[model samples]
Target: MSSGIMKRRPLKAADDKVHDFLTTGIGRVKALIRGSVKGFAKEHRPRSKNGRTAKAIFAEAQSPTDEDGNEIMIQVKKLSKIYGRRPEEALALLREGKDKGEVQSMTSNNVGLYDVSFDIRKGEMFVLMGLSGSGKSTLERCMNRLIEPTSGQVFIDGLDFTSLNDEDLRIARREKMSMVFQNFGLLPHRNVKDNVAYGLEIQGIPESERLERAVASIELVGLAGYGDRMPSDLSGGMKQRVGLARALATDPDILFMDEAFSALDPLIRGDMQDELIRIQSELGKTVIFVTHDLDEALKLGDRIALMKDGRIVQIGTAEEILQNPADEYVDRFVKEVDRSKILTANLFMRKPKNILYETQGPRTALRMMDNCDRDDMLVIDGEKRLIGMARSDGILRAMNAGDRDISGIVSDVPSVRPDTPMSEVVQIMVTTDFPIPVADDDGILLGMISPSAAAETLRNGGGE
Candidate 1:
């Protein structure tokens, strides 16, 4: 009798599996695990606190997730103020002048804000957003009392801000808050280290202590070796990092970033944003961010306060802002957002039931694949050993194979381990032609899927 011939793949070594998983199939496991183990070997799993797992710490440290959650951190109550002179008629002013009783208001005609009220949670990044001349920056300044409000009260950390005298306010600034400006505000004459340490030096820290603190701050911003460089020698992003280090070096109660990254190029801006996120994750500082860019607001805000004409229009998170826009203005702001990157697979992924993948027939597998929005189908034999995958291309190829052989085409094989990310799955699809067989580490088929299905799911309300 003829020996039963079986097509067998060369067994790969342990390291090869790691290399393949990392390089060709990264997205398949990008969800929980970053890349494959071989690749992530160098990647220091982000250190967590109190010996907690990254998952638990992640849940704790993700960020100001939404408006309602953010409200608990920072609170503003019926905050109101105005600027720019209301049209003062000459006749009315003349009558007032005759009285000399009209206390001449020295306030400017430009109103920065009016009756703004909101609360931001601890570990939240609150963003103040507005367009040009909308008074968002003015509100930011007022929040930290950078530009003193003409009228109305401000409170930070329940300190009754408007009530603080100059001496008290100055002390609060030194002890409780740090600010970053759009212009960076670096000292041209000072080197990066000296400029960053300037705040500590101003606070009368000893020279040795200040220098040590400044070096630590620089490393925190990823400018580890650039301490001696001057402001003129640094790039825009590096300069911003210096500003970040300066703000952080103070170890204040809150960080105020006022258009801190608006000056950089898009790529550099993204880098800075990522850096800020990493810093925020590590430090967990309360941040009050000011920006005009809606994208930036969406990118960073735990709760975004949208301002118009010196008044708050809406305050919510990226999801809330995208899903429940307050008005046409807010709607227009995010009309063209690509939501896939924002929403994750947690919104989708349902278990397939009544999935039929008989070894001989393609119809069962195809139907199941369609309903699950999966790119491929799982194949099984009598014992359900996940024998193979039933795929569109394989079925077509079987048809083209004509008379002699069709059974060998759709054999179940090469299943990926569970906990693979969609990105990894897509990368595999790009590199390989055959329908990818997904399996547990023991090589049991759990069914098959493809990159296209993942994209479709994301497009469809995150498979809501």
Candidate 2:
């Protein structure tokens, strides 16, 4: 299997079956029981000596699964939305490759979305980001069927949400989806507790049960004592919390947030972002968040779908977008981003070519340096734990000194964890002549990040 990271592929039927089995508790239990029975029947099972499971091997081979192993919570295919009296005609013009503005001008209709398609995976904070009129919010609205899409299909867990009738769609909205909007959509007359309980109330939940759920949700959003206060009394951030609590009170599987944090002050917005992360970590709900601020999108999104002029231009993780922009628009979007804070050692590091084990003699080390045409080599123990650095001169000196092993000539080298951000990595790189080593918590040598790689990554961010 190649060591390089793999791009995600569309799910196959077999992959979907495996995903369903793994995601469902009953299916997982059945599989575990079956494995145990087979093990008992054979009295033993063969284990890989390297300690990797079959699934892990397949994943390393980049077979049909995403690296995060998240299930698809929502899937949108060829989604396009047009506005105006005759949207169907406008959609036909769009399908003919007419420019959005041209189609709208020629048909006297407005384009709200332009063939936007993507997936929101389970437990992932997927972000929709774009300037106003870019169709980010429109796309988000279409996901929950708040705005009917003129053309395209929306599948929620393999069920076509766009195909559902109004009654069934209403039921699905109540039981499966919850939305938080940019404006704190709170009822002005109602107190915070009542506002939070409104969704449950709409669902016809009993008063006591609804209030209990609402209170728990209010507390979850850090508005425990502020529940009794009216929206008028609470600050903007607090009111937004009420909105969050209201949406969460229903405990729906999918969350749709359209600019939910854009109204708050910067400090409060940062706090809310962190709070959302904490809550999402605990709850593991599938979240589709909409934002216009690039910083906010980078900070909050697990994967961002950047929209431009009613079309999705790019979709990727922050690092992926920074390191490999899809086009000039994407290039401009990431131009001002601080690569040091977003790029990690894992992304910047390259595989080590020549390694010297501690058990090898100085002569062996020198020979490798000549063959690999390198001045220095990383020294590791038998278990691949990086211990030190060995220079060609040092190896020769050790050999001349009659040392049996190169361990005597080994020197301490700078190292970092795989996830260490490039912000700190640059400081370490400038002080060391050697390529920085990337290791895990256990000190196992994983890869090397040369100074040139760091420079290249920064340059890719449109920096020096």
In terms of TM-score, the best-performing candidate is: 2
Error of 2 at 136 (Å): 0.5
Candidate 1 C-alpha lDDT tens digits along 130-165 = 887777787778877877665556656544667776
lDDT (tens digit, per residue) of candidate 2 on 1-464? 33232323334656888878768978678869977875566332223234433233223222122466767778899998888899888888888888788987798899999788887787789999887899999998999988999889987776677887665666677767799989989999888989999877776665667779999999999999887788999899998999999999989888999899999999999999999999999999999999988889988899999998789999999888878999998887676454534778898888987899998998878888999899998999999999989998898899899999998888898899887877678878878787999999999999998989878866777122
- What 10-residue stretch in candidate 1 is worst by lDDT? 98-107
For model 2, name the residue pairs that clash: none
Q: For candidate 1, what is the total of clashing residue pairs? A: 36
Candidate No. with top lDDT:
2
TM-score for each candidate, following the candidate numbering? 0.54, 0.59
Q: Evaluate residue 286 in candidate 1 and report its C-alpha lDDT on the 0 to 100 scale.
A: 90
